[model samples]
Target: MTTTSVGAPKPTRHTADSEGPRRSVRRRSLGDLRVALIFVAPALLGFVLFYLVPTIRGIYLSFTDYSILGNPIWVGVKNYVKIFQDKLFWNAMGVTLEYVLLNIAFQTVIAVGLALLMYHVAKSTLIRGILLMPYLVANVIVALLWFWMLDYQIGIVNQVLQWMGMPRVAFFGNEFWAIPTVAFVNVWRHMGYTALLIFAGLQAIPGHLYEVANLDGASRWQTFWKITMPLLRPVLLLVMVVTITGSFQIFDTVAVTTQGGPINASRVIQYYIYERAFSQQDFGYGSALSVILFVILAVVAFLQMKFLRGNENDLD
Candidate 1:
């Protein structure tokens, strides 16, 4: 045998061979990381500039008494205190909750039905495009279109009602109908997009599972309830979280059509914040409202993910 140093062991061919591959892998990983960083840099920069900076600034402004005319003066929890006692704030909150409930209840049901219809009956891309047409239109345009269509006096809907010997409905003018009409408008706008999202989730489901269900003599309703709904839970929860958050931020439709009319019936929390900020020039209060809304959304999202298990996949 060849003599070696007393304390030093000779390197084996196995070790040498393993090290070469390991070094190459390490270098490749570093290269991949650089490429990834380069690709993500734009999105990261945009997030920092547009989202993160504004959020931090809004939080800072929330604690002050700025009115857009002078420098912000720190006032601690004064704004929060005022908000707690503000009647209009509570009314806006109540109206917003009502709108969210109505919008989500109807939107989720209709979207699920539409998605199932698309999956089972019509898998055409052209059909999907047609369905998504409403969503692609500008929100302002949609609101205006609906506003003219549902007008109490001169709208086509009213004209049809008159032809059918039915009384006219004051869709935007009546307090009782105002919130529901607005909620319906948004539901109509968002239904197709939500359906497409659920459709994607449905696509991920294994065909073999459905085949097995059929072999077991399961009916369509049984298959849906057992296999489809259970596996589709995560997607449903995710969709709910997204839709609920968006519903809470209802502003454009109300702004375009009602302008929070019928005595604050359609005054959502966001519109109230807008009223406080730009309309009244109470930037500090508006900032405070914004911070509150952010916190609420964060809490809601966290609770939904935690309790509803939004991220968990049963497919695993």
Candidate 2:
């Protein structure tokens, strides 16, 4: 052993030198991180200033007694209590739920059908673009346009009905017809975009899968059930979430078209919130209502997620 052998490995000067560069690289990385944070600072600031702060403030306001023009008085859960006891609030809740359920049902069936139809159509882009024109139109404008078209007497639909010897339907004027008409208008405005989303999903299915299905002598319905639906799950989930979220937040259409109707038939929760907040200027109560809305939406979204990915045999 030349008197230099040792049982343990000895540290080398070269190893020490190598560590210097590693330290230098680490310092540079830290510098780069600081620069990256600096670049992101404005967006962080904007989010904190605009969204986070307001959300926190709104949550606090929900427990208070403050009209928009008045100073906030901490009244505990009085606002929530009031809203819970309000019959109109409960009615709005029921109406809103009905709209969401119906909207999602019609959208799911129609949009999926449209997607499947367009998947096979020639010159699809042109057709899809034309369809999307309705979605591109502003909600308020669409509602107003539909309002005119569905009017009791002078509107085109009624005019045509009159000419065809059918009774003029009171689309927005009747309690029973009011909500359905608004919901229909919503679907008409948004169906194209929903179909586009589903179409994209359809396009993503591997062509080889379909070829294999054909080689297996699979019927078209068989192919659809086994291949198409399973593959479209993710996009379907996304569409469900989007539609549900939008349905809960529906206000502009109800406002512009029905104004909560001749009998509050079209008064969704959002419309109810608007009545409390802006119309009556009870900001605190409105905030409480919003908080309830938030909880309802959160629960609904959680359930949707659970339903989408929860099953033990599921293949997400």
Candidate 3:
């Protein structure tokens, strides 16, 4: 419908429809980006200030002899060397490793079991809240509650044991039982919390998958193994990573119940760090240990991520 010079007659023009949509989409994306940045800025700033900055500064301080009140003295790797040579450091590290392993085992198995039980039962808000009640309690309170429950003389647990004709044994007072007792208490407090997280993952699984499995006459065990466990890998890995970090850094329960007692048996890396940095005023060595712990957690988390991503590709 356009007119032009005779030589340029019939020159074609493209419609604006396609280009218009592309431009509109770009504008909308930019708008969304701006909104996202605005919303995340406060949290991002807090994280950088509180966590990232401290982490970087702490790592730098690990190579220096630092006391909070004085300027840091350049110590190179002297602190690290001392930590490596210290027998108590290795003992604490061993205890931390054992705690992490036991916690991961208990938390993973018990959480998964409880999650499965919840998934099968009638879904009720009350039930969910009750399950998570212990997790909501403060760490100190959880420790105190378990401490009383496991007390040798006046504790209900020992009384019940006595009723069953079993001898009453001191849990935290014995070096051999101290670590396991604290680990068990931690599991009891956190099992429901982890289970609820896993339950949410269980809920996300498509119902049609189960229906198809049912139609194929798959046994419950086979369906659970073949379908549920595979689909739940990501969530399980998340729980494992978190629980491992927490176990390695456990402090409140040990402080309240055992105080790393009976022979420093229940002393974890976090408590060790605390005693060194604050109580004994050995900031440099503490920072070195902190760096070591950070490295350990980073390696574990990276491994978990690698495994999770590998499963994703396989699942796809």
Candidate 4:
């Protein structure tokens, strides 16, 4: 009986080597995660402190009877009820909707048209630069310039009307003209930015598509309608959504030009909220109105995303 003591099988060198690399990879992955967290910490902290905390506090304050000077007292939905009953609130809502629709329609049309023009004049750097100049000017400066241009007595617009043998109209004074005048100014101030965005989308589209369309003997209008418009749908949708939200939040123009005047014709939801919070010192009501605005914006953005998502798939 030659019983040779069997030595324990030596651990496989290859297995040991594989274990080392796996351990190294795991360690590297953990290290990378830690670094990413470190880089994101500041932004996370700022978002929580500035946006999340304020949003939560505002929502809480909306259901209370709070003023600037006093502690918030629970009041259930009285603020919301009052908002529903207030005639001014309804009027402001109607004005806000009108402004939103007008701005969206006009801005989309002008911006898309300008973007199409810019696409064609892509070789002209000077033209593109000139087109973009208005977007760079400060809002206040633009408002002031327009103020001078639309002044009732000394304005260039009225002067031009007189020169053209038309009656000198009060652009910002008359109730009928006030809202439209402000809308025009808003359009002028923002159209360049919107057009630039759409232009970027147009440039991203492959030039080969246009070449193919031309080879197929497609006319310029046909090519634009079938190719450019469809390809730029995402950008157009984004611009429309942003314009709608901004229109709903119309304030600076109304403040600087009309002051929500000519019988509050230009008083949008934002102006109403400002008055409730600052002028009347009713913080709770203002917060309630803000919450309502937030809800509307959220719904609009969601619907826009849903609509655009379908188009995106089609494009893909």
Candidate 5:
């Protein structure tokens, strides 16, 4: 018999199985990633075309003397300098700050209060659905509705006051009350949404934690302070950020209700920006103001994130 080498390398069955499956898995993973990218492409394109490009262009235009009819001339900070020198800009800044602070304070308080109430209620689903009705209404519709209700004469608010033997208050006509009145309307429109967010956060807390707290003889107030509040800090910070930014950008309500009238008392930064860009046709100044608002919001958001994250790390 011819002595064929019995030890001549037999095909490694394990190697074939392992290598084939590994290649197949890698190809499958790559295909999945490709599919995911394809799904997200439209959204990415839309964001770039609509938001990102316009934002970059706005920043670039802020440094130039660009208007509707003329070519942009390089002005280098002239627009920003003008903004600093403009007394109206400072006044608008003040009004914006006042609006932001008051709205944040009242909205946070009322939203948190409502969340707490809903948390303890027997019919939470019904309460939440009722509360969210205002949020579902369009902002323009809310503004129009409130505009009628707040009308100085023949409005529901004034009628209610007169019926209750109180003075018919001039809400929009007076400079002192215009900002507050607009802010109050904003709170009314947004409070339900904020409360719903807080309520969701509250509901997400595990019932076992509360049970353990109760076993430890903790009262509701004690449990809230020691457990609920600490756990809810992240959501509260988010609410603060949203409320602050939204309040600072208040425009529609001011436009519909006050139109920056009564000596520009209700003129927040956004309305000022709108007036400069569209009404007055000063795009450079408006772009500069827009940049300023962006910077202010960015700084506040950064600080808030930093502070909150520091607290979170400590807790962890």
Candidate 6:
């Protein structure tokens, strides 16, 4: 209700002008959200249908007796109670632990050493490609290849051992050597990939720190201990979590090479679960075993992250 002279400026609807851009911005935001959802829909759907649904179904099946031939009968905690009294379960657990320890110990140390060598000596793409080739091969193929190569009768390894004046040892046949031989095969297959992971971590470390250490007259060993190890802890934590979990779920190599032979020598927990669920048609017991493994892995991961301070770095 204000009058304006001809020479004076005209009043503009600032509120209306502001609202036009606001509405445009809101429309743009909604359009972007739609695009994002469209992109994410496939993976989200996969997670819900495959992972989430199977996990829930498995948990429920753990409480019921589902033999696939008949309807599931709810047995409450009976499967779990049976698992507690199962000596085979305990033996599988112990054997799996031995495999995990052997695999992790050799794999981590060798991977770190290879990473260091790659970082310092040969940082070539060709070398890295050759190292990664074993990992690219299928697990079954790798296991079978190693199985034949380590065969006691006419295998290359045994031939070399005999040439060296040592008796040909049963790499996969004997109970004492079965688990270790299986562990070694997996270690050889996976170390290259693990080395690349550690190599990436090494690349992240600041080079200037090493230079400063050199200026301070620090020995190579001292620099590695003080600088490299501290900064590398986070990456090591990640490597440990991944490798240890995968090691616990060892089945393919054992299935191919040993088949849990020589009196359950290499029967890992996963193999045991597979036998119960598939061979014996005891889904409830298998599911209960799977749940126990899940709990163990969860606790182990939590402990590793907590103790290693995985989220925190000493780069400061």
TM-score winner: 6
As a whole number from 0 to 100, the lDDT of residue 312 in candidate 3 is: 62
Please provide, for model 4 over 1-316, each residue's C-alpha lDDT reduced to its tens digit, 9 standing for 90 to 100: 0111111112233344566666665566556555655676687678779988999999999999888798999999999999999999999998888888787789889988888888885559898888778779977788778988999899998899999999988888887888788888888988888989999998888899999999999999999899988888887887777777778898887777777778878888898899899899899999999999999899988898896772572356
What are the per-residue Cα lDDT tens digits for candidate 1 across 116-224? 9999998898998898998999999999999999999899999999999999999999999999999999989999999999998899999999999999999999999
Candidate 3 global TM-score: 0.86
Every model's TM-score: 0.89, 0.88, 0.86, 0.88, 0.87, 0.90
Candidate 3 residue pairs in clash (backbone atoms < 3 Å): none
Backbone clash count for every predicted candidate, in the order shown: 0, 0, 0, 0, 0, 0
Error of 2 at 175 (Å): 0.5
lDDT of 6 by residue, 94-203 (tens): 99999999999999999999999999998799998899889999999999999999999989999999999999999999999999999999999999999999999999
Report the lDDT tens digits of candidate 3 across residue range 1-316.
Answer: 0111222211111222344565665666556555656676787778779988999999888999988889999899999999999888899999988888888898889999989989998478788789899999999999899899889989999999999999987988888889888999889899999999999989988899999999999999999999999888877877777887778889999989888778879878898898899888888888999999999888988888886773462245
- For candidate 5, the per-residue lDDT at 21 reads 69
User: TM-score of the candidate numbered 6?
Assistant: 0.90
* Model 3 bad stretches (over 4 Å): 1-37, 310-316
On residues 86-114, what C-alpha lDDT tens digit does candidate 2 reach at each position? 99999999999889888889988999998
Which residues of candidate 6, in runs, are more than 4 Å off? 1-32
Question: Model-by-model lDDT, in order?
Answer: 0.89, 0.85, 0.84, 0.82, 0.84, 0.89
Best-to-worst ranking by lDDT: 1, 6, 2, 5, 3, 4
Clashing pairs in 5: none
Per-residue lDDT, model 3, residue 39, is 71
As a TM-score, model 1 comes out at: 0.89
